[model samples]
Target: MVGSSVEGLTFDENCQVLSVTAPAGASGLPVMVWFHGGAYVTGSGESTKYDASLLALEGVVVVSVSYRLGIFGYLRDNLGLLDQLVALRWVRDNIAAFGGDPSNVTAFGQSAGADSVYALMLVSDEPLFHRAILQSAPLGARGPERAEMTAALREFVSVDASTSVDDVLAVQKDALSMASARFSPSGGMPFGPVLGEIDLAPAASRIELLVGHTADDASPYVPDQPEAWEIATELVFAGPARQLAADWTTAGGQAATFDFRWRPANAPLGACHCMELPFLFDPAGWSHAGMLAGQEPDPVLAKTVRSLWTGFARNGMAALPSRSLELGE
Candidate 1:
């Protein structure tokens, strides 16, 4: 919403928004649409953490999208995923005006955002984008069933259309507490795209896929429990990603996979969840994020990773190594 807009285009007041960044004097460039990750409770495309200017400088048109979060996005329905679908339709129609080739678009995300991208692919009837990049997607942390969510919500205060946003958020927090207590063992989110509500089938066409996870993605969450860290990482991030990539290939689709093992020097978390983000985007955008451990991404490595991403977007043929990728300290 902070970038150029098409005349007569308007978004509803529920905050379904997107921001665009295109290189100067560029035309017919590949487009990358991003969805942010925050366990389905936080994050937005407008946040400084997602600035796309550096990505656009790589000669692609970058669009960062924001959809509803928390109860508004998931409790009543999977509105967040629908909101992403709408954003994709918008890009399909208007991205050409921003010097993007609508036919050559990639949908990418991290964590919950990556899960949303996978959900979008399952529900979309048309090929809205040509490729997908799912980074650290918690494919194992699927949302709970509608009945379970309803039961959880019953433990909190009820709300009506007239309820204040603050009041609704307060109730939502309580509901999440209840839901997490009931579902955390299975890696379920309190509010996100729900399961067993709709029959999910693969998209009409096999999308080119690049799916991967960090080597020590769960270290931050269970730092004191090394065994728990390993189990959680495999159950929630790495294992599912590997299976998905394998299935995609078995289904005769082009797929690439990577395991990021580069940890910041002296960082306690190792190559934890979201560690790859700094390499994909501008390091400055993520400077204040404690996860990066006060270190900037290696410029040489960042360039290499971004180039690999761009190469995949251009032709869907970048065969990233299946082994762990490490950076020198």
Candidate 2:
């Protein structure tokens, strides 16, 4: 996968942005900008599990982004909404160079990354992208409250209540380092989109959405607990796991929901949180033991997922070619 770097003009301190290109010359392909999931802390643009070459081969330009993670990104006034907004703005301006349609871009993410996509949809009225795909992420009470985040930031940075904002800014890096170290014990930085504000508001009724969860999503994150799945379902789905369908129905948004309950032959659970990625990216030789083992290319599932994604990017509605709904009708 050939690629190039573009420096973001607006933020001089930001890293040089990298975008992978398709073998087909950059001309008029739809762009898919991906955000990696690491609980908003770890992970990078260069994960082997997220190789976009397959999607690029399918006549779409795929760009995986690197954003400030952990304290650097999420320990902010507004839960790093500004950083994501900057990334979206950058994609809108520069993706055209890599054969992507700037006007036909889609934002896709998993886990915390999925939260970012929903946050972007909620906050941005500008419509930087045509559509969004959120995987295994449900609304949480932890997002979109700037003052709460600011207080957390103060604790994260270890600034005295009397410290000036300029002093806080001066010690930001040291604070970030300390905060990153202390994050896990303190339950990590409270990061996610801010709500009700213009920059991080909820999506309006007209916005199209594709939202779903895996049957065993909670297993990997919290292993060995019999009730982990139940807890996760209740916390994320906003009630019992069974009632998610009803909750989604009451939300009054245009969306297609999938259960993704089909696990592989050797796996115990169907469709864990990050399971759909290999099917999307076709990670052939990568050795990520947790998620990418024995993941052979499923042309049928790949075609279905990518076609739905691209179709949504083009028309704000994802239609599978198989004509069968993977989730219940």
The lDDT per prediction is: 0.76, 0.59
Best by lDDT: 1
TM-score, candidate 2, is 0.73
lDDT (Cα) of model 2: 0.59
Which lDDT tens digits does candidate 2 get at residues 156-206?
A: 565655876556556765654554454431233345444554421234444
Number of the top TM-score candidate: 1
List per-candidate RMSD values in Å: 5.0, 6.8
Give a tens-digit lDDT track for model 1, residues 131-183: 88899888876634545555566556588789888878898787777776767
**Positional deviation of residue 187's Cα in model 1 after best superposition, in angstroms:** 5.4
Lowest summed lDDT across 10 adjacent residues in model 1 is found at 1-10
The TM-score of predicted model 1 comes to 0.88
* Colliding residue pairs in candidate 1: none
